[model samples]
Target chain A: MPMTRLYVSVLLIAVLLGNNACTHYYYAPNTLQTPFLQEQHDARASLGMISGDEFNGYEVHAAYSPLKHAAVMVNHFQVSSGSGSNVSSSEDSGAGHLTEVALGGYYPVGKYTTFSLFAGWGAGSVSNNFDFDVKADLSFQRRFLQPTVAIRGKWARFGAALRFNQLRYVKGEVDVEVGEPDLTIIRNIERASPLFVPEAGLSCGFGYQAFWADFNLNFCNIRDRDDYHFAYSTVGLSFSCQLDYFWRER
Target chain B: MEKLRIALPLFGLLLLAAACNKKADFNYYYYEPADYALISQHLNLPEIPDDYRAQLPTHIANLGLAARPVEQDKAILGRVLFYDKSLSKDGTISCASCHKQELAFSDNAKVSTGVFNRAGDRNSIALGSVLNFSAYYGTDLFGPSGVPFFWDNRAGTATEQNLASMTNPKEMDMSHSDIVSAVQSKAYYAPLFKMAFGSEQINSERVSDAIAEFVNAIGSYKSKFDKEAEKAIGYNVYSNNEYKSFSGFTAQENAGKNLFLANCASCHSPTQSRPAKMKANNGLDIATTDAGVGGITGVSADQGTFKVPLLRNIEITAPYMHDGRFATLEEVVEHYNSGIQAHPNLSEELRAPGGGPLRLNLSENDKKALVAFLKTLTDTELIADTRFSNPFK
Candidate 1:
């Protein structure tokens, strides 16, 4: 009887915590694109949920159903720091890439549409940029066409998406012109706060599912420049997997 | 009844529209100009000239200034840039390395020093009357506001003048990128770049203008001679004939001043003078290793010629003459006094026959008073002005 009471109390506590903890709060401005519902491939692949019978080189679709349609989905990024760049050198970041860990949760309201918001932080030496809060913005994924092949038990979906992001450097404000203009002195200047830069990106991903779990992966261009993606786009790829326990209700 | 029902539906739709239009929660970001230190003092000459507006286009056409206008923020940014040694190959020297404010903005050494302590062949001249100097030769795309800078009339425009130091190999010894890194690293200058040029990127013309503004800021108008001339003081000593005449004068000093007016004024007139303001080729050396003006223009008539220097703070800018050949003002005066050499294209003022009319010979007393008068031209207040002190320390 005591263990039964403890079990009920533990479940109640989990439900309370799950309800109160701020899942990555994302701000979905009306201008954001709608998430593609038919794009189940990315939603599943991000969680690395693929069936044993799945084949390589062939795009696949995956599905995930939760008791509550508005539950938040988060992404984790492992990030690092301490890799200072050579300010005078025109070189690329060749050091062993550091992991910037991040945790973000976004919400989806329907099968064909999703308006998700997330606030996460990533810090690595390669970032080189100053940060206000390792953060991200809302992404609207819409499933224009849901590719469905003859499935055995679980259903699947696949498509692409458009994302809008913001990068900030408010913590780096600097005082530039405060000092006296004495050309006679050399080396330093007036000080001020650090600088902040804003950026945008475009992405496409796929997903898969099985009796046990669901997974997905997404590749995107994450630069803030207007036409920086004109020639060769820098890519950001995310991989994720979720437990099959959430599907027990089915 | 049907018409009333349709109208009521439209009213309901309008009401819903207004409800949706109500304000929602939001966040935003804003930027403000970053502050910086002024390492050198400036005199803010001639209101930047009304025509200075015209100089903007040529500057914008260049890749550097196209990023920012020649406006206030850039002027301030240029001040800091003028003093940053990181803009050089080695961080020891900077734009202010040679153009010191205490020395009338000119270097105190004979030949200007550069990175690695490499010395230039010519003396570093003070920065003033730049807008009033000679014009350009049109070898490249020059700017509206330009002037003659070096001993030779080499650089034609302010833009060119700004670029000269980078290429000189002895001065700044840097490309635009190195300066950009040095500036952007300050943690403070990133915003200053935005304040001055509205961007966080740095370039050369901006570097030149900042230095130029600080340079133009210091002037010789505060001299006792200038202050008295401006009526700030009572009818001063220079206004009296007793001072200029033989009354208690060093005979050599009077002779030197007379010789100066007759032979040197053609080019090296006081800053207050106008027109072909002054360019000279004193019959100093017959066969010259330093080609002077001729080296710049490739003209035979200009051989061994050099810009006649302003005599404002000549005492401190010593190691006199273009090559800094004379260590003392006495040696310089005596060079023309009895040692005028014969050259094929020497100035007629010094080359007149009859033993070259050695008329500059004077009693020692004459030399003393003249030196004293020249001393009065030195604005001691300028050298000690705290406004131009180093900002780093």
Candidate 2:
């Protein structure tokens, strides 16, 4: 019974992670494409919205099958969010924005499943304004690789993916302008070791005719050189249209 | 039908995620300044002067007393709570009832009277001046090794001390919940609490924090001694040998200062170099009924040991000692002069070379000089500062 309870707990955690919001500042795993090549020249374009506790953003994705067994895909994501506050302005606000781009390939595994891989890079910047004319800014850059697998039925699809990322903090500075002595603190983070981030994702979708909508949930565990680990999660919904389907006769 | 099976679960998950609404984003700006004018008008709070935020002297900082800066809003809120009688069960007593600012924040009574005029066990200790009690007692002085508060040192931080007093049967005679409800019921507390903590959630911890801030801000650095010392040797007079001569003092006052530095400075140095290490059995009695620190520790050597109170404004804080047995500073000085008892656990400083009670055998003039020097330590500014005075008036 205890083992059963443990299994249920794990399943619940997985479901929660799968339904969480997007990674506004961090790398997230790419969603799986179940049938990589439905036809020799199959092409699909998707627009998605990602939402998380820390960020809200959008993603654009395009995939085209050049061969009967292989397909190429490209995606772009942008997210922005804010937190904290500023006392002088009577505004408590700190904001961050992230931009990421990726290109990948997929290979059909069976009649109903496919495997895909992607490599991506992202850049993010955050700024905070505090009381007494104090402002802090931080910039980050990261690279990631993801592998995924998916199974597809006539109207539904289920998939999972894992993303491995390396992150580097580019710059962090704080500028204070109060009273006589103005001070600017530029942190030396160049010597800081890169962080290793491991991410996992779950995706599901249903479609009718030429349009399809899907949900993707990604969870990432980031570990710094000091071995401190932090976890972040993001959830996204994507809408896509198979353009060739409408052009071809039934 | 098949779509419904997958749609319901997914819908439920989305609802759960939205319900969580976890605050994970980094906030860029923080600290919204409260409407101070509104708070002041509602609570009858006085405006804090720029001098109230004065920096500690370099000499005092060199003494290793850690600094705990108090926010102005928090201190103002704390002042209200300090004087509010609603903190007591019967609405008759507050923290300031015993720790009056005029008497260096110590009660003139031997032991302070609590709710229902109940007498406490130990004399109330002075907690005034620019010295940060929380920094001294909670962190720097003896806090690293877990020193407790009060005469017996049963509590730890100022927060713990306030909570203990509030819940003690002999003190405020109110439970933690009762204190919270009382503050919550006061309409004036709403804006003050919101200004201090960014919320109006009246709880015990926030109450303790505000009170501690006010207590920490009751500093007194504008004494005659401070002026004389600063003029003679500048601000960094902690280790200046020239200033040790008491250059600006009168002949008798200088003589008394020299005597104090020679005899009492080991435990009561104004710079706080050699603060009492835990409690010491100050040879108060051969056998004490009040076990003091020993009662809490359950150790034989600790029996009759009590914390050494700071002597910042000792002149007005009389009725001295843990039990407040001595009524006058002369009598208190005379105890060290010739009246030390031969307790087995007598502090080593008061022990004779042959292991009996150490006697000063001082002349009457020397005793008088010592008393005169102690009076110089008084800071009239602290006693008269409207910032530390009751705002209810």
Candidate 3:
């Protein structure tokens, strides 16, 4: 019953935040990964649904502890307004894809507590189309360094994370025919290339033995935000599976 | 494990290659090289003079006229739109067809010929009448100057005014859809649109906005009168009072100017800034035949009242008045001197104390001097500036 309620709540938020028209978000904050690895060969994989102000989609994340006090992670995400839609056919629509890889380390401070840090790089493309032919298509790369704290119990776990990210617009073509504020927004994004974006995340999960339902919410902070038209926050829910066969015997 | 490691790095390289930068590239994805070369040879964006981007003219500044700042890209787009004949049905007319650059942006005819050689009802308004367009029509419909567009002030903003002209049966005779299609069909305009706006999307609002910006960027305040006025008041003094005659003017010109200041400066400002009056019935007829502003408002009091135009560039923009009844400045001056009619809605300024027309029955030389002074209001540079010239070969 509780799981059903959580799914319903996530669906409601996604619907409410979908299809923000005539806006081009330069960056969409992804949920910070805080895998709390405690031993070698411990692994966790998750698939989540994402709800953003201008984009709604899904993401997949996997983390593995290769060595004691050392771990690696990979994340992939795809977002769009609708399936098989472009600006030519729709009043407002867009699609985007990103994948990142990272390596980090963790220290178990207590029986139920762990602290970790991760650094990663990601590449992606984002596009927005409105007013029939006015569109912004951009290929971008993001670099991030994150710090996290986690608490674990037998069947439940919680984590907090802060990720400092810098997004660089690598290249792409933009055709815009809008005026004023919308035009100004595109110019500002171009002017602010290699933009510094910072985000905070809170994640929690409840589960049985090796499977869990995870929920996460992230918020990004940008200066002079009113001049920018983009999603600053994202909420996600995911199903996570864990494998610790190597750590179980140890 | 070795194959996986090789594939992972290769995949990363591929992703990075796919995301390679192409920032600010406006060329078409298919035939970009040929299109870029053609457009480059044909259309060179104007290098707007520093004088235009500099501080407003002293007289205009004194009135605190709210004019839009010159945006280089948008202005270029506007210039292209102003000259493109495709905006009209049958491709026979453009805004420039009537608002010619040579004649101070006013046609030589009594009334301009439009699409299919249709005669328009009113004279083509001179765009160079003020320091700039925003100074004349202002930024909005009910802006600081309260200036509306058209001879009758029927349209509000420059966008509305241009749209009305484009759609008018006797003018461009093109619908909004037709306008978009015409603009979209032109391959050359795509690059210009990308330069002005961030893309090649041709739509009516963007079209009108670009044209308005271009029109607003028109006008040069470097007239002889402007130079003398600045010298008289010095720079940034805000007031042209205390000085009665321009030092640069001849005795006859000064005499004519004094007469103008006393008789005509109220409606057409001496400083050439915002005028004190908007529309007035200068007793054009004993009865309102065309009705003018009254026709739009259905107001009896507004009968025969036409917009009071700035006298700047009056030397070239002849065939004057709303109906272009006066062919020359002499006729215009003579009408004011001896031909004001005793109409019911004749402006109070034109009313004699005896409740009839007032006439400044000046001598012929005085009339000649007045015309000479009016000629000083012309800005020679504006008529021939290449920045405003047609880009088409």
Candidate 4:
């Protein structure tokens, strides 16, 4: 217990120290969607509340299987946050949203385990305003490949996923009034992109029949951090509904 | 199998199509890359003129201090840093916020505002009010040999003074490490830093050095006083009997010049290139409240003594004195004319025969003429020089 407490303390200290007052985060990974389907004609839909140090958001996830080993997924996320008094910049508010679609195949390894590989594309926009003087509105596109493994029981489920993503800023509009450092940062990102980011996630849940509740944690890191500000961690709570035999019956 | 193979390639092509690379527009007018390019083009760092490399005085040269010519690249980088408000903690204040180019690099405010609208304690001094800063203080030196900085002479060198202003709670309110990180995080600074220092590695010392180079290059040698003095170079301008008045000057201006040479030149230097004194007590108050240099040394004898600034561009840099107590040149001249307080550490030059503050009793015309002569010190060219203007678009 003492060791656990010490580790927690160190992690908190690292987090607090790493996030200086001047740093502005531009991106955070969404919660991993793990639809533990066992056979053909299976489907699941879930809604999650996402939270992080700089943002609070919501996500919608839907997954379906039409053939024996084929699956398709779609996800949407929206997040908004405002500047606290501790923030050094005069940023008044910020918001961002992303929607993605993926097509992949899943295989049942045993009665309780499944392995899946997915290829996806996502696009999003982020906007930040500073006391009406400087407004940054940017749009970005992302292409990613994700692999996931999951375990399921009558009443419990566990899952893990790793996503490799290529992120590129597609378009942007920044107010001329945006002063140095911020303006320079925007120009740098535009010139030095597209960035490769890798994300990892873990989730655990309890279920009975068709309904389930899950807790998720995810993290992302930029491979080449050349003047980019991305949130490293996110935590989410999801409620899901599963319809395994409904499509088979029809 | 055929359908799946076609679908895979089709999906890949779809993703590739996302790379339209549409350029961003600012207010449907300006593009980011183009703006940066335009700014880069405008800042064609001009070479420093030879006249700016004036000879160091014998006393300063004897102390191993030499006039270092300003490098164009370093000065250009420093100019950007000077105007960049991002150096402040709140991104609202910069060195140029107080020291403006049009006002002879001085603030009109009695005490300038800093980050978060915090009020400063002392009036902002003009950068090259009387003499070029490098000629007077010797840039980059950080010890007792060089003249100190600030109204109180609290900082040792230009770098220390820059750092002090950056970190002051009422000023920029940023740490050295934070400033370095801020500079490093900015992409446009990469080229600037590389140009100035041969690499993009940024540090607080380098930042200060660049700003010092830019500031040291600010010279005000084209004033009317300088032109008039130049014509009197061969004549015995110092001796009243042999010296004929300046040919360029009107009768009234020459009268004012004569009064200034007799009274103010003891401390302010008749040549107008350098001040005769670094710091002195002008008896602004009988008992010192701000303490001035005495605050730093904890010495009572040094009480009320403040840094003596050059009088160049005095006509425009109003709200004068360390605390900005005087509002105009008339008020400033009045203070020295008849209102010098009897402070214990009053400057010897301002002492009367009875050991009190010397009152320069003069007629109304004499005061007006003195004011007129001070106006001759204004350098219109320096204030309008494009090399020192803001480079940002």
True contacts kept of each: 0.00, 0.00, 0.05, 0.13
Tell me the DockQ of each model, to 2 decimals: 0.01, 0.04, 0.07, 0.07
Q: Residue B84 CA error for candidate 3 (Å)?
A: 6.2
Candidate 2 C-alpha lDDT tens digits along B220-319: 6666666676565443344436435556788788778777876787677655322556677788888977999889989998889998765778889888
CAPRI accuracy category, model 3 = incorrect
Shift of residue A119 alpha carbon in model 1, Å: 50
* Residue-level lDDT tens digits of model 4 in A97-214: 8998877777899899999877788899877665433467778887878889999898999999998887778787776445556676777767756777899989888888788988
Q: What are the chain A TM-scores of the candidates, in order?
A: 0.32, 0.67, 0.87, 0.84
Instruction: Report how far residue B83 has shifted in candidate 1, in Å.
Output: 1.4
Runs with alpha carbons beyond 4 Å of true place in candidate 4: A1-250, B1-67, B139-145, B240-243
Q: Which runs in model 3 stand beyond 4 Å of their true positions?
A: A1-24, A53-55, A80-96, A108-112, A172-176, A244-250, B1-103, B106-256, B262-311, B314-372, B379-388
Candidate 3 chain B weakest ten by summed lDDT: B22-31
**Model 3: which residue pairs collide?**
A171-B21, A176-B198, A176-B199
lDDT to native, each model: 0.42, 0.66, 0.77, 0.77
User: What interface RMSD does candidate 4 have?
Assistant: 6.0
Number of backbone-clashing residue pairs for each candidate, in the order shown: 99, 23, 3, 1
Summarize candidate 1's per-residue lDDT along B281-359 as a digit string, tens digits: 7778876667788887788877877876667666666777787788887777678677777655566566667635335
Where model 1 places Cα greater than 4 Å from the true spot, the runs are A1-250, B1-72, B128-146, B232-264, B270-278, B353-359
**Which of 3 and 4 is the better model by DockQ?**
4
